[model samples]
Target: MTTLTRTLTDTQVVAKRNLLKIVRVPEILVAVLISPIMFVLLFAYVFGGAIDPGDGTSYREFLIPGIFAQTVVFGATFTGAGIAEDMQKGIIDRFRSLPMSQSAVLAGRTLSDVVYNVLSLLIMALTGLLVGWRVRGSLLDAAAAFGLLLVFAYAVSWIMALVGVLVPSVEVINNASFIVIMPLTFVSNAFVPLDSFPPALRVFVEWNPVSTLTQACRELFGNTNPAAPVSDAWSMQNPALYTLICVVVILVVFAPLAIARYRRTSR
Candidate 1:
């Protein structure tokens, strides 16, 4: 078999193993499914009235895309936690004994986590509709919007995979991810209007990958404020392009790192 074929075959085997674990440990699936619904309700009814996207957009409309971006990015944590859990159980040693592609283990872990993210997105989309979030754009545009979110999410899963392999404990992965992810999501335009940020933070928010992803979603989902002024920053001006760049850069940098870490650990 060709090297590429071998890698894909190994990756499928590893992905099936991970997916079976989710079926066995159903609470993992339950948590993934529930949190986005809570976020939708909390932000829609609880905080929706207070924060305005301003200029006649329903806060619920604005909120759903941001929540979509945030939740999927957060979902990437499963990749790390899963990797850490497997390492602790000495599962990597078993994989090491097989004649498989070295990159397949990490690749499979990240790919399987995409299934988790997709299920969460579907549940959240249904909840968003119940809360008055509508997709005003063409169906193709909306599909592209979701496609971008998943691509960006898959990139983040690799980052977490690296961290998971580097860290000694599955519990530590959650704590470590929270420390970084909270700031990235909160400090951006996810839950609030961009104009609310101060000058220094606004710059950061404008350039933040999370913010760009949110912006990209808003445009594709047809949720942007018509009156909002267009920013000159390259990231804000072309958010879809910007977000795609972030996805590519993240995968290029982290996928190999995670694979190398897995190899070292197996040894």
Candidate 2:
């Protein structure tokens, strides 16, 4: 077989092994299933009232896409933590001693996590609907919104996976990596509009990738109130382009770095 085919075969093997492990350890799946629901409740009821959406729409409608972005970004931290755990338990060392493709192990972990992220997004979406959030866009637009979220989640997973391979301990990975992401999520237009912030903070919030993704999702979902600015720009124009650019930028920067780090660490 060709090198590319051999690599893909190994990736599939690793992915299957991880899937089996996920099945055996039901708690992992359960945690992924439950956390997003909890976030939907906590944010919608507790903080929703405090935030002004300014378009006569229920706060839940505005909050759903933001929650989706936040939850997926937060979920990525586990990618690193899981890798660290495997390394600590010598699972990674065992994989290294085998002749399997070097990049497959990390690729499998990331791919499995991407599947996990999709489930999480579905749970959040259902809960959002139950709480009176509706997608006003056409079916195609809704699908595109979801597709972009998944793409962004996958890109974030690779960056987190690199952290997993490099960090010495799961505890450190769990604590440190999320500190950066949490700020990235909250500082943006995820929970509220950027104009509401002070002039200094407004700049950071406007430029955040989370803000960009959430705005793009809002547009795709047909949240068009030109008077209702989610940021300096709320128009749906070019949302697909922006989402594509963000995905490409993230994949370009993080994917190779993650693979290189995994190969070196595994050796």
Judged by lDDT against the true structure, how good is candidate 1? 0.91
Name the TM-score of candidate 2: 0.93
Off by over 4 Å in 2: 230-239
lDDT of 1 by residue, 1-267 (tens): 999999999999999999998889999899899999999999999998898877489999999999999999899888999999889998888888888999999999998989998999999999999999999999999999999999999999999999999998998999999987899999998898888888889999999999999999999999887678756799999999999999999999999888887888852
Regions more than 4 Å wrong, model 1: none
Residue 238 CA displacement from its true place in model 1, Å? 0.3
- Candidate 2 lDDT, tens digit per residue, 97-145? 8988888988888888888888999999999999878999898999988
Listed per model in order, the count of residue pairs whose N, CA or C atoms clash below 3 Å is 0, 0
lDDT of 2: 0.82
Q: Return the top candidate by TM-score.
A: 1
Collision pairs in model 1: none
The 10 consecutive residues of candidate 2 with the worst lDDT sum are: 229-238
